[model samples]
Target: MRAIWKGAVSFGLVNVPVRLFSATENHDVQFRQVHEKDGGRIRYQRVCSIDGEEVPYSDIAKGYETSDGRMVILTDEDMKSLPSRSSKEISIEKFVPSEQIDPLLFDKSYYLEPEKSSVKPYVLLRDALEKADRMALVTVAIRTRMTLAVLRVREGVIVLQTLLWADEVRQPDFGVLDEDTHATKKELAMASSLVDSLAGDYEPDEFEDDYSEAVEALVESKIEGGEVKAPEAAPEEETEVVDLLAALQRSVDAAKAAKRGGGTKDEAEATPEKKKPAKKATKAKKKAS
Candidate 1:
């Protein structure tokens, strides 16, 4: 991948020259807006709203409308006047425990590779961060905008993860959480037991995006068959909801069964659904009596 930015990480007297590359990539299939009949790509042109005239790119200028309906035009020089510290350097502010930083503040991650001459200093800083178990708080300017970022050790390399500003994180003032909704001890205990039964280390590889895979498979089948086919019908089941205690017991049993090479933990819980229709039969017998 091409490097997005080149800069030096400065801490104390050490300067680590490095190039930044984005850590994540999008794998989504892209589509375009097109004419439905001819499959021609749709296009848009810039035009002046007031004069109703086609405007050239050179005529465009950034403008903000005031509350009084006045247009305030800003030029390139106005933007250049803004302070940008991360243009060519990443200055470390302070080191804090990795846990101290909230995960929500993280925006984007980039991989940092040291220049040939700065390898020693880079290794020194990387090792120090690894050993101290701390992440360096830093501010960087990308694309003329100042951004909060963290300098951390990832595997054997240093990673720069951009963070959101304090003002960017909105405070939760919604009254829903303030309302009192209590759970009984028995219910909480049963829920905890249910959770324990299903508890296991999170391995991301164990999960798959089934929906995406199904869509891709459908597309492939359509390509091979040269026509669309009706989807296979799924079993129709009633939404049977059992009582609290009964549901908990059934769930616990199902979890045990699943751990013992049976199907998912929901199997035993579903057996209670058979009782729903039986209740209707009892009501019919009562009416006949």
Candidate 2:
């Protein structure tokens, strides 16, 4: 909820004062390394390899190794001399269609709230971007580092999302895909049909961290003085070599059944009944009387 950064969004002569807050948070349980036998906390030390001695923070200096095995030490002042692009302001370089940017480039998102006096300009920019269906490509400096980011309108609010540079993305090597592949017209058609049958509107709430939930359950069981029972591993069913067309057809049929409210056997069995026992009803009536 706390604002991570406070700055202004600048484009040409217009500047909107805003506070930036992170849109996401880390929810994973954290663990620390410890000695198993003594249950002692493990500690790390910065040591020099050549001298085999722990170095103090004051003694540590940044260095770069050269081809001749010589290390050139860089002082704090030397590092400060490096040209910084992201310091004072968030600069918007260009605006591009939101659809044109690849989803993979998006890293993290932050909510932007404008100052009271700056609301007009903020809404102006937000509405402009919304009308154009475009996002502003921006560069901002945070903690001495420059970041490539996108400024877009989300639900009447401006949002900034940090992006990864083009060089950071690894090229998808299609060598494996090109090896040996052949599909019949009927097979491809059936596969496409199966995909269409399974397609649904994206709902992030429907997904969950099942593995984390299981792990938490295991931890709770252990903490409650109950023996953690090893789950009986289900036997892996052997995969049948079916005709591609037939397999896709089966998948399509299953998807269609799911979409049509036809509950699976497990779902039907798991559903709780609404009927109450006569004895329980009598007991409740007696208690009320």
Q: Provide the lowest-lDDT 10-residue window in model 1.
A: 233-242
Check candidate 2 and list the clashing pairs: none
User: Alpha-carbon error at 166 in model 1, in Å?
Assistant: 0.6
Model 1 misplacement above 4 A: 67-70, 225-289
Give one digit per residue, the lDDT tens place, for model 2 in 156-274.
Answer: 88889999999999999878797788899999999999999999999989999987898888889786986434344545433344456676886676667656668773443332353
Question: lDDT of each prediction vs. the true structure?
Answer: 0.85, 0.83
Task: Return the TM-score for each candidate structure.
Answer: 0.71, 0.71
- What lDDT does candidate 1 reach at residue 265? 56
Query: Residue by residue across 1-289, what tens digits does model 1's lDDT show?
Result: 9999998999888888999999999767555776665555566768899999977666889998999999999999997786765478888999999999999999999999999999999999999999999999997877767787999987899999999889999998989879898889999999999999999999989998787788789889987987543344544432334356676886787788778866665644456578588889999999999
lDDT: which candidate is best?
Answer: 1
